[model samples]
Target chain A: MDGTRDIEALIEMMARLPGLGPRSARRAVLQMIRKRGQLLAPLAEQMSKVAATARECLRCGNVCTSDLCEICLSDKRATGEICVVQDVGDLWAMERGGAFAGRYHVLGGTLSALDDIGPEDLRIPQLVTRVREEGVSEVILALNATVDGQTTAHYIADQLEGQVRLTSLAQGVPIGGELDYLDDGTISAALRARKSI
Target chain B: MDGTRDIEALIEMMARLPGLGPRSARRAVLQMIRKRGQLLAPLAEQMSKVAATARECLRCGNVCTSDLCEICLSDKRATGEICVVQDVGDLWAMERGGAFAGRYHVLGGTLSALDDIGPEDLRIPQLVTRVREEGVSEVILALNATVDGQTTAHYIADQLEGQVRLTSLAQGVPIGGELDYLDDGTISAALRARKSI
Candidate 1:
């Protein structure tokens, strides 16, 4: 209302973003307009490029500019071990750790009873096919520690029970966690997994 | 990144916005991608249009698509009283308040000695010309309550000492403010401006 119709429309659209409300969107739009050459022009160009080139990897569900993502194409990541995650974000997290030398399988989301999500809605069937066809020896479930994540993990494990070896990431306190701050569930899990040093 | 180069670039650009960080930018981009036709495509188009059309009013320093802003062109707002503000944002704030019937003159920014900003850097010269030409009887300095805002207001007041009636927004406790929570300056200002009941 304070600017041109086009500017107002842009602000309205920006306000629909996850983090920005109307007020923040207005501020952002104003800044962009003020610094058009420095920020707005490049951002608009990048967004257009992403809208045109970005696509999901056919094999693993990760986003890529081509048919297959970089990780899916890399021979180094073909360790006959597949790390199954709930989303591409989780797959990236695992990659950032620099420990896993295997490829990834993104489920898109976990099976949720309340949300009416099931195996068919996810990459469960594709995961099964990959395990059998790609000579996968291990299937690591690196899902979140939520209820739906656990249920999906169990479902996947049951499906691949005799077909392939299945495992999941452990649940415990974080690396920089304080003992006093640890929840009862974590404390119990830590105690149960305790080993003599 | 979890996504392609194009998508990563878009997210990086979004992260530079005022309210959004990298994490929130990722979320926003993901949502936009999911609703490409309904949201992302339209938003991109609108941004492009805004980038091309948005301009500042040469007379009042307000954002516009043409030579004059909406307020500057509207005959309904010519109340012979000019509400002076620090920026278009402050002008918008006044409009949202719905108390003023007069038109506005956006100053672009307050006079900042630290930034070496002076009256020439703002619309002070244009404001003087407008007052003389429009037969303006009153000039309201609806500037911010900050030190720079007050300093700018005093400077303007000195320039137009006898040209027109000068006033400012009252400094006092807000409508729903608690006395215990208010600072000493605000409390003192409120006490000094207390009305007879």
Candidate 2:
């Protein structure tokens, strides 16, 4: 083997990450080597620690070190409103807004016809169980604007209709979105959903 | 600690890498946790192994597990020609082209007047010593097309004037680069360096 085999292997593994390609992986590996004490050691340690303990929260499908997520255990979050999202990343995005004080249900992914993924493939059944078991009053579907995402939201909406107050995020112009840059569908939706100021 | 604290820490660390930001890092961490046995465990194990053994080559400053890098140790590489680059990443790029059979000398960084970086800050002195001692005949400066990079290359050339045959990469229009989008300076340079191809 080459003398740099191990280092090359490390770089290859890092390149397989979602956002990093070979070029950035090489830079990252070099940077890690440069700051071994401050970044590499701690990162390596944390990765191992997290790899050992991290798992899907049994209650909400959020990543956690235990069976139940922090939001599920914390009584402070509003139990009446459950924001359902397609992925944990979406759940985190909502948390970053700092305005959503309610708990979440991560669906892992949306329904994909091409991939043959359906309700059973995601955490839809678990979400329905949570809605009934937790006395949830509002089931807000915060899925993406994608076709598959809308289909999944509609399916979930149908599941919980008449049982509780069901709602989905409004389809309209986003905050600070420019009208000139918006697509025809978005512009039409925004016009249709126009509100009095 | 919260149940998701460890997972969050892992995401934070992943985000600090070159390509990944907060959102992508969260997604990458979640994927890693999901594929722990297949990807995460192997990656962590490989990183730890490399972190323990990785070091810079004494001769060329290339990352390696031994005193000399693989390129330095290889008998097939030309000893008379040394491709000088500002960073190890640049050296790797040249290698990816599969044309350069010469050894390399990594300067680590360029001479930056604003950053107070001078020849002494880089591996310039060691390079001079290597040229004198290693029976080198050519030094090809493959520095970036940046102000600091040009200044560093000029400084190194001045230091080794008449001692060796110094050359640099051609600066002109990139292959497949649209002429319409080309900057004025680049267009002028390409005109000036017009070839018979």
Candidate 3:
């Protein structure tokens, strides 16, 4: 325990991460110490580098090490369509899917009246400007299915009404999802939007 | 994802930790980026410090930032009872219980015939020298109940049989353990060592 204060502090910090607890943090720190050259030193350097450079993309609020994100900088992604999502995590998820070929607009968070979050708090004003100035034809609301997400989508749709086509991701049972395991809401949504083969 | 190469590498390194996977690592990195000033920078600094300073205690093999650990330096811990554990983690676990007032000897690992590990591979030679030179009266074999742990404990006992008193931790059903949920081996051990109420 003596002279282990720094290691203990490191464990405490690791425990504050999203999924780790005290036991796991202690294990991780011990392992890092064991693999100091291969893991601990490199990790510290990488973290410091990221901490110094990581910033939000000025155009879409996505995390990047520069003024603009890769998607926002790519001319190929300027396909007259802008996908609006609640957070940078959602943007990353959409990118992982690789179906969308257009640029994105990260709102940072949904408009929550209870939390006093409005369009101004998110990047809604920037998104509206992008849609108008960039000659966007379609504005897709890829926000979550939560109530606040829907409210934010409606607000965005109202802002761009008649000027551009407004749409949202289809609500349905996911691919390979068992009907028995799905909620009633998903089943109903899937049934209502059923298509003939 | 272009500017996220450093961040992605950080996540990959984090995923190598014992209890974390890629998804959890990604989530942790995102949170750290969000709380960059409060968590990321401080954690990086602490890890670098630990990496630069942490070393094995010369006396007991416990991790510390000095040649001797706190317990080795403390005169009060010279109680003539040395608790021999398989690893520093186990020693920390005993310290957490706050029952033991004596010193500790971390063996680093159990002797394994299959892995070709012998007394020399662990700190057995050092432990023997410590017992002979430190005027120790009692040595508690606090190794695990595994086959290799028992083998190592027996080997140490044979080495110090005539020199000092030898003992081991009691085996039984854990506190608050129910008979129905307990394993047969543990139940039998508890019954064999049953104490009168």
Candidate 4:
């Protein structure tokens, strides 16, 4: 690992990913070698491009390649509803289902008192501001079912009570099920059966 | 969605991510708008830097910031054992465990007759060459438990059955469990109990 600190560094970075590690990183590097032309080159190109240009949506906490995320700028998305999630991955998961018609508000993460995470730590204040400024009629809490996540949902609910229609994803999502792990059917079911918190 | 071609182009690109759709891409774009400094700017900067330098390892099939991967160049890793895997993600998973003190060979993909994928379609030929030249003593087939994976492993066994010790991860892994999903303990357990193929 001495000569290729660059590769090691890449692996190290990859290891920090949600489900990767050093050994897996090494194997991945090797596979990238063989498919350099097809997969590796394109992935690297995109990764770099994203790394250089990718940014969180200033309005909603989503990742984008631009200054303003498209949903915030689009006139058509003014449906007066905001679906809040814990991470971009959850937002992506919701998108893959293609069931929701309104805009989104990514929380970046949930409130965790143990972690010293609070509303400010997430995007709660920003969400509150958006509800008032953007004329949102509803706020959908699409966060995970984790303890911290529920705490966050409750906090947001308390902050937005009587200001808008407040709801949470229904019972389709199993306990401890991250949005990332839920199937399209489950997400759709949860969204359909959404209940007021 | 139509203002800046470059930005729209970026959303289009992002839409192609594994889980992201056009709608999510749009929402993602909007979020980037609000947090240009805190998230978007930094992500873009990092993407640019990675894009400029990211390359695949010449010796192994891993993605690297240079031609040679750190593991391939490491003297300590030259333990004559080559753990073979089917994807870069799997490699990264193994790496996260922080075990295994050998080199690696990324097959890029498994032999899939249904998809018309064969040994030549993957990095099998290169793997054979590596074994011959690298004086590899053991070959751990860390491929998935799928039929295609087993087929590929068998094919490789035929090619180098007598040349090196052949082993495979034990059958504890779920049938369709991608290495990406397995926790560190399961992966380590599989590695430790790997049986001779």
TM-score of each: 0.92, 0.93, 0.92, 0.53
lDDT of 1 at A8: 79
Candidate 4: which stretches are off by over 4 Å? A172-197, B1-197
In model 3, the runs with Cα more than 4 Å from the true position are B113-116
Clashes of each: 0, 0, 0, 51
DockQ of each: 0.56, 0.65, 0.70, 0.11
Which should have the higher DockQ, number 2 or number 4?
2
Candidate 4 C-alpha lDDT tens digits along B1-197? 33334555656754554445676666654455445455445444444344456666777787666678778878999999999988767777788777888988888788877889878878898889988998889999999877788889999999998998999876656778999999887788778877898
Task: Give the per-residue lDDT of model 2 (tens digit) for A45-129.
Answer: 8888888888888988887888888887788996689999988888888888887888899998989889999899998998888
Q: Candidate 1 regions off by >4 Å? A: A1-3, A180-182, B1-3
How well does chain B match by TM-score in each candidate?
Answer: 0.93, 0.94, 0.94, 0.82
Better by DockQ, candidate 4 or 1: 1
> What CA root-mean-square deviation does each model show from the true structure?
2.4, 2.1, 2.3, 9.4
Task: Candidate 3: give the clashing pairs.
Answer: none
- Output DockQ, candidate 1: 0.56
Worst lDDT run of 10 residues, candidate 1 chain A, spans A1-10
Lowest summed-lDDT stretch of 10 residues in model 4 chain A?
A11-20
Please give the lDDT score for candidate 1: 0.87
Tens-place lDDT per residue, model 4, A29-93, is 55444445654455545434444565667898766656777776777777998999998768778
For each candidate in the order shown, give its overall lDDT on alpha carbons: 0.87, 0.87, 0.91, 0.73
